[model samples]
Target: MHDRPAPRPQAPPARPPAVRRHNLGLLLGALRAAPSSRATLAAATGLTRGTVAGLLDPLVAAGVLAEGEPDRSRVGRPGTPLVFAGSGPVVLAVSVEVDGVDALVTGLDGQVVHRSRRRRDHRGLDPDAVFGRAARTAANLAARTGRTVAGAGIAVPGPVRGSDGAAVLLRAPNLPRLDGCRPAEHAGALGEVPLLVGNEASLGALAHLGQADDFVYVSADVGIGGGIVVDGRVLPGARGVAGEIGHVVIERAGRLCGCGGTGCVEVYAGLPALLGDAGAADVAALRTAARAGDPAATGALARAGAALGTALTSVLHVVDVGTVVLGGSYAELGTWLVPAVHAELVRRGVATGPDVAVLVSPHGRAATVTGTARAVADRVLGEPDLLLAG
Candidate 1:
């Protein structure tokens, strides 16, 4: 018999590339909220009138907005008024869990649209596996919204190494698996669009900065972390690690830290450190019990607060920010922590001046996710991409 002919391989079916269509709500909102005219947008976005027209006409035809009449009174060419069509673009945002693979989806304007939480065997899970779950979650969310997803931001639990859009570096001891992962590596699964990652605390600070002018944002979670902003810019340190006050050692030689140092503030103030021998879900639950007068919980928060206060006392002396924002789950116990932090400031040879204000972060859990979205918007829009998404 003749030798069997080799089977021919079939070509893969061609799939259309995801067209870059932003939410109509987002575009209309930008036009209405913007202080200037179409010329200003052209100058800001660097896209030609044709591009704007291409983007705007569909929105107008969809009854999302109506084009306003032009005015010829100005010395130069007439200016057309861009008004809102009422409907807007929807954005899906996610706050990726460090302990669990939980994520939250929200609109571009910072509204909670959907939420999901999943338990994973993270023991041997690598970076690719982590991002795979996130990308799939986002795609499902985008499909459900029936609207274009402008972008997605990820709130990671560590420091982002470089300003040139690199992966985040997990500095927390418990998060050893995420040591040097990059966002660029995981963008494919998240849709070949813009993917942004930022420090959890830094993003939380950005969310708080949307309201406050200047403040030090402090977060006490699986690990303690924070971010500093002056006027409206994240103050990244020379080495890309600016607000890592958690690792500052308050009790020298007291307890070992995950970063291989002994007695860092995290050793005393982190949730894991505070709930020694007690199986607690997180610091939030611990703080709640403490407020209910649970002796062990109260004692744990008191000790952690005092250590945090000691750390803040030093930060206050150096930064002297207008306000100190306490966020994260533990922030519910601000009443107990503030006084101790104030006392430590006094003991540190710094005067309790009248200028400093201690306030809880009003934005709460949504900060990090929002901040990461802001970073992605900055990449897409040719703007300064400041602390706020708007």
Candidate 2:
């Protein structure tokens, strides 16, 4: 019997509280864009004035929001502006890269309040040790700023899954000790607060969200990874490992990669490879050598760029995205590497888009941490009752 397509699994309706949170998210989003009074928010969100006021009043009372004086405009009667509370609430976001860790604090108005980084070789180290160091960094920052950390987001150098303050690091070839680690659990050891763990490249791409409608964010660093954004949002594929271009096989029997794969893109294009090939102690030295017309440094950049181009062609064949944004260290080194990437793309006949752009993110090395802060900050501010309620 054809049995009516199994009744389409009867979707459950959203409860009233759930509906309220959704509306609050909309209102918070509008207010975050720019502060406005109840009337203006209602018009922008298509919600009734009563609904906006009802939802906003409690937030204002709870110090999540504040009312400002009338706008000083000459053309019309001024409306009292409603704004995010200035003093206390903030988000702590951290990114655990292969080389080290970086943490940043962002306020409700989307300003980075404070940031700190620890540069070291974190590869093959214990995950708990690294997380402990990160937690301490966060705690010290909190003490310095005295702003309550409303939420936290952690970015890891591999695939991850979960939400609402909990996630598991599925695999981390770059940082082997982090494999199967629970980032949120460690974050909880600090205290009770919301948390999010995401792939580093994905979060890094998020920092440049408004830069382009569709582009691939290439986070070239100690480990190379890609984050694909299509139609203005990140295209996180099934199992959340959509943009793992670092593991792409380029040269058979070549250098072994952290992922246990030989001749992968990362082994060819990652920072360590570039640095080693140029015989430079660090990025600064490499840049200086290149500026002085050092062949080794210049050649290293070109070879890395070529490897990146080869990796990207696989992405373009399937995704049809045009622009490729060099993020992380790539942004800083774009002047030396971009031409080779473009030349390689042209060689492959894949630089076919009308605009055909390869851009550098303005955030530079801070993209991952900055993006994570922005994402977690949105959650804390959007869901007042869940995160901000006493």
Candidate 3:
């Protein structure tokens, strides 16, 4: 205290964090709806034009937002339309599966600029080794992109406990044993950056949101997983263990599930399980066989559909989700599966009203990765905390 000079007359009080956050929200909202003028942005965000301008300055400097060409033809006053830089810091999204891991390096706009997949012996592999490989793959991709990776998001093929961010491999089918593994343990090798671990289904749900909430997304990938959103927020059930539809027991003392249960829905509906019984290489072949009136394939689809319907009935009973979206490789079978699911729901009379809908997911293989990238982007842009206040 004695050596230091007077605090330089104390700079004026800075703006409140709320004010900054509000302005930032406006900026991000505007950028998302790009090629918009200040007037349009103000109107869209209900912020004053001056405030929008002030916010845009810092964002522009940071390469998050950029000024578009001036609009000179309008009669009243010329305004510069705003556009996103689209080349800001990147977010690497990785999916850890039983047989291999898939990673996508995406830009700020949730576009996959680069992607790579690596195969490994998923069985008997240590959790640390798997995570290290994923982190290294992400780093190598980021280096190749020559862009600053702001963060990394990992989607595991199991129930990721929301409470502790640990990979809960207990109830998943075909996933490697990772009982007490946490994705955060691998963040250190990923540059100690902000890392996000989420269930692939939830991420897929977020991606299909496409900016809307209040939808239920069912992912029919290697296994069946689901994501439920209420009023625009994906609900993380207590312990981040929500949406374990795969383990919903459909039959008693029927086909045994890998999870030590008899006739779990995932046992029949999961592609791998069905493929094992059908002797088909993939779901597409199975679907083809089913469509061609192959008795076994048809019976399998019917069984899978009934189980899916029963499971969906449970979801509909608990959460009054308005829209049910089907996605992933098996979504191609939506033509058959959706009707069966709907029939079961109707037969069971789960919905009191006629508002519920079952639609195909708007995205395909890229859904989970894109959704994770969007999460990272929203976090960086200082979005309102959905968990705390949304």
Give TM per candidate: 0.69, 0.82, 0.83
Q: How many backbone clashes does candidate 3 have?
A: 2
Q: List the lowest-lDDT window of 10 residues for candidate 1.
A: 381-390
The sequence of per-residue lDDT tens digits that candidate 1 reaches over residues 337-382 is 7666655556665545555666776655666666655445434433
Ranking by lDDT: 2, 3, 1
Would you list the rank order by TM-score, best first? 3, 2, 1
Overall local distance difference test of candidate 2:
0.79
Q: What Cα-based lDDT does every candidate model obtain? A: 0.62, 0.79, 0.71
- Which lDDT value does model 2 have at 244? 82
lDDT of 3 by residue, 187-231 (tens): 456865667778888876878766457877788876778888875
Root-mean-square deviation of every model: 13.8, 8.2, 7.4
What lDDT would candidate 3 get against the real structure?
0.71
Q: What is the lDDT of residue 261 in candidate 1?
A: 84
lDDT (10s digit) by residue, model 2, range 186-234: 6644577667778888878878766887988888776777788886566
The true-versus-predicted C-alpha distance at residue 372 of model 3, in Å, is 1.7
